[model samples]
Target: MPAPHILSVFDQDMDRLQAQILSMGGLVEEAIRDAALALETRDDELAARVVEGDKKIDALEEDINTAVVRVLALRSPAAGDLRTVITVMKVAGDLERLGDYAKNLGKRVPILAQAHRVEGAAASIKRLAKSVRLMLKDALDGYARKDLDLVRDVLQRDVEVDQMTNALFREFLTHMMEDPRSITSCMHLLFISKNLERMGDHVTEICEQIIYLETGTRPEARPKGTSTAQVDVPYPGSRT
Candidate 1:
């Protein structure tokens, strides 16, 4: 262990980085929840708020990037210190992507609200969104606490999100086939489900960074339940 005085400043820098990541994660989680709720409730105002909130997340990501860069330049950090800075930057990027997906979902709410609601679509979407949000919370908490077990749990949750997306895909397909009138609503629902699944993927990416930060090597073969070919949803159910 280094002397108390020298260690204090280093600890402060690390703590600040971790705190910023958690702050960003919180905004992202809120965005996901609000976006899903807006879709479910058809609240255009709430959806608009989610869109506007994306800017704050983007600004926070920029702040994190700047701070990480400055730390790298100012301090010739040891191997562990270097890993923390790099991992924070990676986690920030993942969180920013999650915000973008939420923003995309929010922006589509008005279009979806105008269409006829498909039976059971909103409930399924909410379930998917809730799972992704929980995984995100776990990933953020694990990183902040440096808890590898929590990170492992987050990694496993991504598989469930993918499975949910695949099931949603099949359901929407059946709906569209049964009622051509339901195409518009089913299409939007498919996109929302895909967005939520992608959010879970971003959470898993953050988990990977946390794992790497704690242990020098990356985790072996991250869990995945859906393949690109199977999930390549074109026009909400096109087999092509």
Candidate 2:
């Protein structure tokens, strides 16, 4: 049997668009992990590379924005195609910001690497960063699969990252109160962990957007770190 003409063309277009989005996602994720690894290993060269590589991310963002505009203007896609375009637009922007945060984290690695040690300040936050990375991976997989249940799961898992962030902050404050020498390093570590947590939240936001774009219905309970807007998009592929 022959594939339906409209669906086939739409699928081809979506394939290209999704490939670009996934490529950007992979780049940003690698940047984040590299920045963290650079810090952990005290590899100034790697840290410097991460900081400098942000330029490529910026260029890629411009290309993506241009491509999205071209699709919107030329194809005038409707229904789920429309939703996917909008979601990709918003998600790419969020990913760009995520890259910025990763770059910032790399910039601060020099300070943490100054003594070849992070002392006690990184203890809890390290765990938090690792968990956030895991969440990011799962959320991206969910987005690619368009598995609403999996995204719903990502929504619920966000609270764990939040709790860990809060706990780490409390512990950081305790260290600050206990010893003057710990204040500076603990403060920097605090910012680092906060950035990581925020990126995790942004990933969750992307997943929620995927849900809205794919289903035209926001979940009754939005996942953690996401507050959704209910727009009057017509349900795509729905029969009356």
Per-structure clash totals for the candidates: 0, 0
Candidate 1 Cα misplacement greater than 4 A, ranges: 1-6, 231-240
RMSD of each: 3.0, 11.4
Q: For candidate 2, which ten residues in a row score worst on lDDT?
A: 226-235
Per residue, candidate 2 scores C-alpha lDDT tens digits across 130-224 of 77666767777888887778877877777887766666666665666566677777777778878887887887887778788877887576434
Cα-based RMSD of candidate 2: 11.4
Best by lDDT: 1
- Candidate 1, residue 102: CA error in Å? 0.6
- Whole-model Cα lDDT per candidate? 0.87, 0.75
Off by over 4 Å in 2: 1-10, 115-118, 221-240
- What's model 1's lDDT at 22? 90
